[model samples]
Target: MNQLPFFITIPLPDWLTERLAVPMHLHDDEARMRFVIELSRENIVCGTGGPFAAAVFRAADGMLVAAGVNSVLRLENAVLHAEVMALMFAQARLGSHTLRTGGGIHELVTSCEPCAMCLGATLWSGVARLVCGATREDAERAGFDEGPVFAASYAYLEQRSIAVVRGVLRAEAAAVLDHYRESGGVAYNG
Candidate 1:
């Protein structure tokens, strides 16, 4: 009989490490979305994972907390989406299960709108803001299923005190998804 593993490890690609070695302080929404969009594009160019990326940042000062690219195909875990990975890393880095602590407020920025699982995680992640680039329609057009996200989803987040901002750089972010589809990228959820 095969032994059962008790622990799970999700590793980021080496290129991500190299890219994050520099200090990043994006002071505005557009800058942060552009950075996340670049990471999504690079994820495709490097053939590492899905064409999606997310980052958690200090809302007050624009200091980066953590960043992640979609690792579903690479890590063989369907739940390892970019937003989940970023929130996980951010929680680990801050040594708290929730980001709403006395230290400071944080925000999550993603290259594309989050799916149902990621949106649920965002609410539990305790981030004060949720910033998105591309829309669910953009992802769907690229053959990806966004999974039950709707206008009420934004309302739910807002009701929970999480400020939701969408379409920060829609054109650039949607272009990445289009490029991924054109280049024969797999839509794991489709």
Candidate 2:
């Protein structure tokens, strides 16, 4: 018989939680972009497998519900991508499996395009929108082995009523990945 891997909880430090906490609002694209960028930087500083970060925000008010950085090393869970971690944290805070709240959708913002696992999670995450700073090509260019994400995959998200916004702050997001490479960060594909 084959054995499957399981996940264990990885608690976030109090300092990190406090540092990432932000009020919910609307029309704060710049702030949200900066938040994700900082998350990526923090991830790199922590020496994670990938310098990526993600956040879940209230769509109506822009409240940051949860933020997470890549924790494959910290948690020893290869599947715990930043987007997944953020969603997990958000769900825990909301005490619900979904991020939707009273007809308002949640928004997911990530420093880079989500890999296959995270992308699939977005579909069932109850997030109405997704914002990405860097592209999969950009990550690949930086020597990161991103999952297979074809144009049709994005189209499918749109078909499922999820709004996809790419390149919200492309250059800035790409710079984070570049910094990771320059710092000799590992790009763990698995």
Candidate 3:
């Protein structure tokens, strides 16, 4: 007979926790994207996870709620993408299944455009805005399979009232992806 685990835990890397221990309150999109990009770069340097990172922030004051890096390799789980991890942690931190119920609006800042699964999670995450750094082409060029995300998919999110911003700090964000590829980082889904 096969055995199945009743529960699972996705542990955050020690470096990430230590970095986030200090409070942060970014004031603009560029700053937030830059912070998220740094997290992605550090994830690569720390060898804890994939070269991607995301954070959830309170839109009103730009206070970080939670941040997470891709832990697919670290946790040995395919669904542990950066965006998913961030959302899960943010929701857990807020003690709510959806971010909408919080007193303030929330936003998700990511170092790269979300893949198909992350996009779906973003929709259900109840964040008022989704800000992306690198483009899908950038990720694909870095040997990542970003799944079937179409322009219409973004339109769908907009239709549902989720503000979407893309290509923030493009060169900087894509450079991280390039660095990861040049360093021979594993493109797990490629």
In candidate 2 the C-alpha lDDT for residue 55 amounts to: 89
Whole-model lDDT per candidate? 0.95, 0.83, 0.94
lDDT of 1: 0.95
lDDT of 3 at 31: 98
Each prediction's Cα RMSD?
A: 1.1, 2.8, 1.1
Candidates in order, TM-scores: namely 0.97, 0.89, 0.97
Span of 10 residues, lowest total lDDT, candidate 3: 1-10
Off by over 4 Å in 3: none
* Residue range 78-142, candidate 3, lDDT tens digits: 99999999999999998999999766899999999999999999999999899999999999999
Q: Report residue 185 deviation for candidate 1 (angstroms).
A: 0.1
Tell me how candidate 2 scores on lDDT: 0.83
Candidate 1 has a TM-score of: 0.97
Task: State the lDDT of candidate 2 residue by residue for 59-142, as single tens digits.
Answer: 777878888888887777788888998999998888888877534678999999998889999988988899999999889988
lDDT of 1 by residue, 1-190 (tens): 8699799999889999898889889999999999999999999999999999999999989999999999999998999999999999999989999999837999999999999999999999999999999999999999999999889989999999999999999999999999999999999994
Q: Candidate 2: where are CA atoms >4 Å away?
A: 1-7, 21-26
